[model samples]
Target: MYNKELIRNISIIAHIDHGKTTLVDRILEITSAIEQRKMHEQYLDTMDIERERGITIKATPVKVMYTADDGKTYEINIIDTPGHVDFSYEVSRSLAACEGAILLVDASQGVEAQTFANTYLALENDLEIIPVINKIDLPNANIQETISELEDLIGFTEEDCIKASGKTGEGVKEILKAIVDKIPAPSGDSGAPLKALIFDAEYDKYRGVIVHARIFEGTVRPGDKIMMFSSGETFEVTEVGIFTPELIPADSLSAGEVGYIIAGIKEVSSARIGDTITSADNPISEPLPGFREVKPMVYAGMFPGLPEYYGELRKALEKLKLNDPALVFEPENSPALGFGFRVGFLGLLHMDVVRERLEREFEIAVILTAPNVVYRVKMKNGEIVEITNPAKFPNDGEFEEVEEPYVELSIITPSEYMGNIIGFVTSEKRGEFKEVENAGKNRVVLKFIAPLSEIMFDFFDKLKAISRGFASMDYEIIGYRPSDLVKVTILVNKEVVDALSFIVHKDKEYAVAKKVVEKLKDLIPQHQFQIPIQAKSRGRIIARTDIKALRKDVLAKCYGGDITRKMKLLEKQREGKKRLREIGRVTIPQTAFLALLKIGEEDK
Candidate 1:
């Protein structure tokens, strides 16, 4: 029942620390969406970690009403998206719900790595770009330089850029007016078959899965039977609601609208982001385009600290999975760590976020093993296998060829640190340099074709360290490439521990093995007898260390004893040592496994 011309659906996109959340706060204030006394800084950032880190971790959507000077009231829907490269999927999904995007750039810092990455995504979604410069009130604000960068990198001219400060509340009104004047309203047929794009969803114990979607065509109402285009599952719509910063029940949602639909879906997996929703009775023949599934880029084993809590962890994972469909996990058992789950994530940050949520939300402490990526192995018998866990890797000569994932990586950093970065990526990480170009004054963009395995570790931290925290990066999977990779097994007292095994490039096997053995030697407590720590790959020992024994001086009090008696005592002590060695089991502490995350830290 609303005119498309009076509605504006837009998303705010920017880099981390670029004040996207603050801008949203300013907009809410100007729109009077919330009372002045009730407003707080970063009002859109609902998570504690988000506020603490000053970053938007989740994409949040809200509705605001603004009365223009032209004596017209407009309904604006703003989707505030996270800017970190790790949350690129979330940003992309949020962008899909909008017809235009406000690209907020830091006035002093200009365009960053994520800025370019997110701008490209918005362009990919065919969203109109409204370039805005934020934090212009700062003393170091280089408005001209930032404008130059925008023009050079994103092809935005000076006339297209708007300057604003969320802190001082300057130019905010102009920005909103621009949204009403410049950004095009969503255009769709409200009478067509129902077609809604599911941008996000959440699980509620009482209401089940609440799907956040954008209506592209037709209208949806409560009690209407809805069907998911991808899953082809139908459920009666229980409720339709919109975010007026709070959930408000609505009679119906029409085309060019962003709202939530509850369809009695208990499992989060049933409602996937990027999936299309349609009416069950008159479903569309084809779903919306760009419906790609999210695939995990990293895999790791998560084991409960207490073995008895495995069941509790499983239930927690199931509950969390309802909200996060990107998370994939399966039951796995480890000889050293006992029962655990092999969880897959979009990236390392996703893994960390999931782990944090597990501990904080579920109150379950878990020990994680070294992360790994899937590898394609061609067996000697001509069968191909994809392995996620190193314990499942084939032995040497058992596989004819091994292939590992590769990526096309792009990094933006200051020109002063370019040489060191090139060396770090090409030599230390085994990446091949593709090209380099000027980004702006004293800034450069470097491209490389590298193994995904390298970036999966501490590559980002290393890059940041070398660049003095100014470097930004983004990457895309470039498919699998054949490589000389091996599964390195760690043995304690001649017993292989599946949890400690990991896949490594064959060239760095010896170095990685040496580091692991060294770390384990320091972490493992001294046994009654010497416990040999060995790293073996392809049935050949690559490195070894021993946790020395804590020997008792059994012969100390034998001053008055005969030589034969002393000798017998010594013989008995030797016998005890032999027996202990034969039956001894070394308990590897969790810290040893955590040391794997510090792979290159010592060198740095």
Candidate 2:
């Protein structure tokens, strides 16, 4: 038992490509947390997808022993968080595992939107923020300017910043020592019932579900019957372990210790991120509720190209859910995309992780439909429905009113481009500016309130373009509004495909959605029957296009020496065709079906 003062827990937060993981790698190497020569750069990004993409999708926690100047050996738990906005929620939960955070501000980019987004949450949590200026080795590294930004954003002084080059071993040792000296110890009564906030959990085929949790109060050991405060499901702990970043068996985990526990639980959603775990026999009276149900801000239908891969599709999702509990998939039969699942995610990167994981891990090629946002609907009788799938949408006459999810967005950009960004956000994105503040002579921060549905597709792309790629944005769900929204439904062969449909605000630019549907038509090889693709709204058809069958293509002509390529192509097409739940004479893909339900698929 760590009686009074043996544990130090901290989380690292930074914007995308701001050297968060790189710093973590160096810390591990310097502290000997990793085996010599066994470690590589960004070693915390263990998954192939993460390393290849250079982003951390899943949060990883590592335990290291550091000796402080006060001559005390403290057990420090370091939690590495994702830097992208998509994993903001994940970052939020990971903070629950630590008492403090090391905020790395890129010297060149200075403080970014994601940095502001996460730091604000850290402040709300009342956690100490240890300011670190990373990438000091960059030729353009403005250490002085970044330190000033940190002082403004995080209430730290220029002299207090730890200037370090995570790439080179420069001044990184100070960060380790400062973590022990600067950050406060975790505060909670150990006598209380065991309460662990699960930031993340993964399934090991051999060990079952291993949950990574921060013990807020009390200790946990093997043979304890744990209940997920969220699911209310109980399971006996089979193993107790600590993070070597790879699980290492432990005798027990006490308060403030971040570690893993293996239970017999196999399914992923049962061990969701931000869910709390407590002893069922002696359950905590009040579990720490960290968040609302992780709602997918973005939704899309995933289909295998071949109808034969329907089983493969399920297997892929099952395996993905093992590692990615945030990915929600339901066996959805779409008219256009065929056997597809209406998959939900926290944001765009989260969605991308699922898709990329599916393709890379399963070696299964898939053609995914365009993403759409959830819509809020209210009946005259006051019935509220949050629709994730457009296929489940009620017609206009069937609804008293409808609205979409809205978010309060904050953008930090160069002052030179503020005018351009503001105009584009208001005009092209249906955004209403709330405030604009002078961040510095060359920088400004603009805050706006807009619908989440608007930014789901290419919102960042447009923001980057209008600002000449210098702007950074962050957003949080504010509330729901009566969206002047419409459904863009696509029909092939005059039949609606449910997967191709989605909901969107009517006032925003429809050019992106319009182009996506056109691209879908181009990618989808038509059958013997000429399939007519049409976009509709409220059961009224709006936009129309046709997918003409490719001429002079045969399996026999392409089968020599590259059967795998031919099979993959046909498999994708076959999967799409299967989604065409025969509605009368039309055979539609699920993409067409779901696409039809969003605004662009529908006409004005």
Candidate 3:
């Protein structure tokens, strides 16, 4: 019953919306793991948020028993990994669990920003890359051009590539066959001390920390003492499970197969993604290698719609933390916004996903501040400090040394937008434009190395606008360099609010400061009394804004309703009003308050 030499461990990877999930669905259908009568599309990305957003946020593992033409049942463990650049760490984490990857390219879109981003991750892991051109049968499909680009960009030979329409199940069997041929067999000894690389793990009410890892060496059975390297945790393996496309009870999983280990560890840190799981006694010499810490690239302040909902917000975050280990939050007090949380994320996409999940999954309405890149600045005393919130900065004269993280970015767009992109980048005082290459007669590629802080927000929106939605962009973190930057703090009623501040390059500080004050003035409603809006730097107010008095309003008019009905409506308005932090006796609506906190100006 065991055929170790024939098993294939592979992961399917691609850009967002590039059909990696669809391809997985087709593979499951062909292998008959999924009952045909109720077969669906994008089966692997089962989260409701994923389906609604059409992006994969978490990686899932499935197993299919395929009967090859030689009449042999080969167990193929296929892992469906997240496809977005924000989750590149997830990609790297899951890649360690597989021997090969199917890099799916959109037939018409060719090599997109995310496709290149994830492909580079696969290459770095030294996994065999199987090129697959998907959606071959679409009306706008440009298979020939995409094939040529794949050869040029990723160095994949035409003969080594597979073509398939995941929608109609065309060429589905061929892709499956390629996995069996291209990926390597499991080679570690089952007798050696058990070691596995944890790709994804979660906690269950009944099962404790359920870890999904690929057995690299040795075998583990029930009642085995397991230690997780990441958390320095030790717990006895209570149960072993296998994939029936879903977790099922198993006696043990041998080397090269993906399985789950349930231990009595309760904390989430015990089974962290990308951590190593090994035996406690008969201890492994070394933990499974290739572990890297995840860092949060974006920072923001999260507040409740009302002060009474602060407890509700905490519960939502705690629940979300159960699923998203990458999210980090700490209690932060803002003079203007009152008590809130300063949250961190891997990047913008990661931040957006967390926000969307909070709103959609928890049904908690929140006030989110503008995201800023974390900065490492050296003070006048020559000591380096990591700064996230702009309010943490000292007076400009006190800082003699400063450095900001930079990134090398690649952007591809239609030829017509090339000039606009170049001008926009140069004008914004961000990255230095290196060069532009002609991909074809109508397509152009541009490269730039920029300060991460400069392009934190509006870059995506601006790029899409210039390219008419045809540009795809990607970025990688480069080392930091010294920068001449300053902090511009916004003051409402001559009072500085830590949440209403930002860091900017020296040359552009005044302009950005003006915009910030003006936008805040527009968003912050007229107060009961006149209020002053000003931007200050080094104790000097750089810009000023005044909010006029709140002149008029009609009280609730419930003529015919019962006392309970009137009271309920009044309660709603009262609750909404109470949630608004009264800064010097002025009420702020939730929507305008969030807008004033962001970086970019509103649309005209």
Model 3: per-residue lDDT, tens digit, 1-604?
Answer: 5557988889888878988888888888888998887677677777787888889888889888898878878999888888766787888888888889999988888888777777787888788888999999899999888887787677777898899998888988998888877788877888888788989877676766678889988888899988877666789888888776678888888888888888787766667888888888877767777787778888888887677788888888987776677888998886556677999988877887888788888887777788777888777778889888878977767777778889888888887888888888877746799988655436767889887776667778888988888899888888788888778777676556666677777777677778777877788767556777788876687778777755333234666857788667756665554444254554455555567666532211
Candidate 1 wrongly placed segments (more than 4 Å): 554-572, 596-604
Candidate with top lDDT is: 1
In TM-score terms, candidate 1 sits at 0.94
State the lDDT of candidate 1 residue by residue for 481-580, as single tens digits. 9998888888889998876777788778888889888888887789888899998998898899888789888888887957998889878988998898
Top model by TM-score, which number?
A: 1
Q: List residue ranges in candidate 3 displaced over 4 A.
A: 435-444, 524-530, 547-592, 599-604
Alpha-carbon deviation at 159 in model 1, angstroms: 1.7
Task: Give the TM-score of each candidate.
Answer: 0.94, 0.86, 0.89
Ranking by lDDT: 1, 3, 2
Model 3, 539: alpha-carbon shift in Å? Answer: 3.2
